[model samples]
Target: MMIDGWAVNALPGVLVVPAVAAALLAILPNYRATARLNVMATTLTLICALSLFFGKPQPGPYLLVDDLNGTFIVLTTFVGFTTSIFSASYIGHELEIGRLTPAAVRFYHTMYQMLMFAMNLALVANNIGLMWVAIELATLTTVLMVGIYRTHEALEAAWKYFILGSVGIALALFGTILVYVAARPVVGEGVDAMVWSVLVTRAGAFDPALLDVAFVFLLLGYGTKVGLALLHAWLPDAHAEGPTPISAVLSGLLLNVALYALLRFKMLLAANPAAIAPGPLMVTLGLLSLVFAAFMLYRRRDIKRLFAYSSIEHMGIITFAFGMGGPLANFAGLLHMTMHSLTKSAIFFAVGHVAQVKGTQRIADMGGLTETHPVLGWSLILGVVAIAGLPPLGIFMSEFLVVSSTFAREPPLAILLVAGILIGVAGLFLRLNSIAFGEPRGPAAKAQASYVPMFSHLALVLVAGIYMPPALVVWFQNVAGLLG
Candidate 1:
């Protein structure tokens, strides 16, 4: 690789390679060829993201990575790679059912790569403007993918997503500009005003009022995209109408990316003592989403929509954990975010297979998964346990930490949190009992389902719950300290 003089801290091939590869995928003649290329590109991208762990931290004018985003980079790429593998089987079935066309398949594969690139760029970005642009690019790509089927409902969902997302992105940009203006008085103009390292170093000297106002817009803007309640109208419809794999990515990956963007700004606020407290604001929004989504879960008719509410609920919990702003709570929040991403996406993988086999996504129409398909049945049951915060799963570990910490600090709120968890558990078990235990209601339609990826994820979640690695503990400890 020839490095430009300006690219002194150039990565060997991380960004440029996958970007160019996405364009290559767009013109591939056949679906088979394109799928192979997509997998290769995703795998290579994962390698690049992992390599960044050892790559030199380049705190420059536009892009850099230290401990802060390195973890997110790994999480994003790992999930991206797994989702692409799942999409391989899932998309073929959609095409056979005439839900998508060859052209659409080409578009989907190409967009998937672009989304991957944008997410990676966002994680590594030093400039706040570049980070915002990368996230917006990712949002647009997913919006296109969501409505790829071009159904009436899909089109409606896409339009709604576009409108709401546009507003949110605009607000975020405005907040970003405010931050730039805040920094310019101290750091002077040029790229320095937008660079995260420079901003953090000078944040203490910036105007408190500017930081306060900027955080509100940033929270509301990115918070909208994070699918918190009140602003979450776009979420369920998107999940219900889009392809299942895309639903998994939107819920698992996209939400995390948005939350990450919020945390970056929150760190800036944390650096300024005179700035308004960011904690209570996040705590309030988090609690609202938790309560709102919990009640909403019991009313969901569509299977995908049911899990969509669950995603909202989990995101709220993670946000609340972070909002508490202690080392233990922050660490728990980080763990929960990672675990939820894995478990939620795994559930969707099962849902996709079940939906394809049964030819329906209604909860009422599906029953007796054990009799019809033991593999999927078991997968769904395990996923429910994992997500509902049952023991011996990663989510359980994180929730335990949150509950214990909250009990010490605020017992009443902890009780409320537990109530939410219990209600979610009952709903999931009720749904699982009907779907996995009863006699098979739908046709016993077999699929070329790949259990390797699904089970692999659950197994990892299971292991993480029982025993988190020491290295991971250290990593989260470092990050949790940074969150303060």
Candidate 2:
């Protein structure tokens, strides 16, 4: 149960080691060596992550590895590994295209590892303050990567991401302090006051007023980072302008991590019977983002931006499921989160290839993809189908559960949910059909792409949809119960 003097705290240290090595490797003058080192380091991190899964849950004041975070740790590492592989090819092309210099690529690789570290730290941290710090670290790392291209547009996107992300994290920290203030009265001041387990156990005794105010700030703060609309101004630009691998990581991993932090606070609020209901706020925002992004999807001119909007829409659905706060709803939320992460990343992977092959990011210029690159086109089609919530894909299963749960509790909201899904489905299919079935529109495509990561993600999404292993269901069920 214990690997270090800290007793069972070893998992966290294992997570931190790669990030630390990555930081050290960042300063190396050799780009070739750094790139290979980056890949090797990420591979090692993935191995450690897999090893961590077999260990028993380690509960403590600073860190823990229960079923809830254990699943996330695996998901994070899996996505990280895939993204790193994709990045190697994508970045190589960028270098050839002169889109990135050797120095910038070095910085990108360095920041990439730092981002991985921050995400892992956020997932494992048991203390609220430390969790906030981890989220901030992740935000900073991504901001640098967002602007790596040094284009006018890229710089603008990075600047906006930095400003908005900083504001969001600041508000999150403020919220964290308020939670501590509320908890101090119940758990007493000092480290225990900010310990997640301690706060959850003593939540009922904390002042409801303080918890209410704190949740409001926390929701807006983390919701911004979660890419919820109204406050989601930063997300599309970040996704569209940034490198596609970073786009995949942002959509597939970082947003979920921010939302996880928000859900943890939501759970604390749930434990406090006297506190104001967090459901209405989450439901309202979820509905807003879903509705907003559904309409916005139709108007996207850029391929990447179009999929970025889809990410926003899917995040909204997950939020709505969690807001419903029933056993089935929460379970659906957990499943939706996983599916969206995999499906969205796959979509971006396909997008990256398409953009590179066609030599344009514009949606209008790229048509009849199937005629040119059948494999990439089919992959894109599969990805869009899975993401559009079509049947037999994991997303459809999750969306169905969400709608069914909403129908049981709130039929009117269920109607809205269906409407959003239908809109998204139509938009995606229309766009996909145009892109995949028409004549080849641009220069003949000819670049070898490692399709394993994209296809592999879609395959898993398919398997999870038709037949979720019982053990996985039990795992999510336990985590969902704990979340509430």
Candidate 3:
């Protein structure tokens, strides 16, 4: 995983590979060729991201690679690479089934790479302004992809996402400006005022009033992107109507990217002793999102939509864990976020095939899946079992830590958290029963594509649940300590 000489340049490669690939895919003809090229480009970007471990780069005026973001970069690229593999098979079927056109898929491939580039740039960005630009770019790319199918539902979802996402970005931009203004007096105007590293070092002296207001806006803004409750209306529709691959990225990567931005600001607020404690605000929203999404999960009929709510609930858990900020809680939050991404994306992979095979996403239409397609059926069941915080799964370990830490520090909040988790579990298993076992219903046609990606992710989740490498434990512990 380590790289030696010349690997310092790998930082640029993470951004450059996807940017270049997007350009090439824009004109590339033929779905098969474009798809393989997409995978290759993403693989190269992942290699570049991994190299950051040994070839750590210095903080710069515009971009930097460091411990915290280095982990995020690697995860983002790895998932992007795997999702590309799934997208190839999924979209190929879409073409054959007339759900999409060759032209539409060409556009989809181009936007996919563009989205990866934007997310990478956001992660590596040293400047707040640059990060804002990168996040906005990523949002715009997903907006386009969300409507690629051009169905009425798809278009409506895209518009909803765009409108909501724009408002979120606007609030975020205002917060970014406030940060710069707060820093300008201390750090002296220009770019240095907006550099994230610079802001953290001098934040203690920045006006606490401005910092407080800035954080309020920043949380709501980025929380919208994170799909937190009260600000999460666009997420389910976007996930339900978009291509399944896009849904996977929405939950697995984009939400985390938004949370990353929010965490950076939380760190800034933490450095200032005079500023208000951010824990209460995040805790409130996190709990609200958890309870809210947990209840909403029962109302979902579309399979994709069901899991979309599950994502909101899991993000709530992660947020609540971080809001409770101790080394243990932060560590739990980080672990839960990673586990959720891997597990949820794997679910979407199975869900994608399930919807395709059954020719519908309606839960009522799919029954006796174990009898119909054992691999997909069981893979999805295992995914849900993992996501439900059951034992012997990655999420179980993370959720246990979250609940244990909460109980130790704040007993009442632990009760509420447990309530939400329990409700979510009941709702998910209720839905699972209808889909996984029963009298056969819907088409049982065998899937055309091999589901290696789905199984591979599940295998990782299984192993993580049982045992984690010492290196990963140390890495998460170090990052958790840094957050404090």
Q: What's every prediction's RMSD, in angstroms?
A: 2.3, 1.8, 1.2
lDDT of 3 by residue, 39-88 (tens): 99999999888878886877998997878888789889988999999999
Which residue pairs of candidate 3 clash?
A: none
Candidate 3 or 2, higher TM-score: 3
Which numbered prediction scores highest in lDDT against the true structure? 3
Best by TM-score: 3
The sequence of per-residue lDDT tens digits that candidate 2 reaches over residues 385-423 is: 899988899999999999999999999999998998889
Please list all clashing residue pairs in model 1, or write none if there are none: none
Query: How does each model score on TM-score?
Result: 0.96, 0.96, 0.99
TM match of model 1 to true structure: 0.96
Question: In terms of lDDT, which candidate is stronger, 1 or 2?
Answer: 2
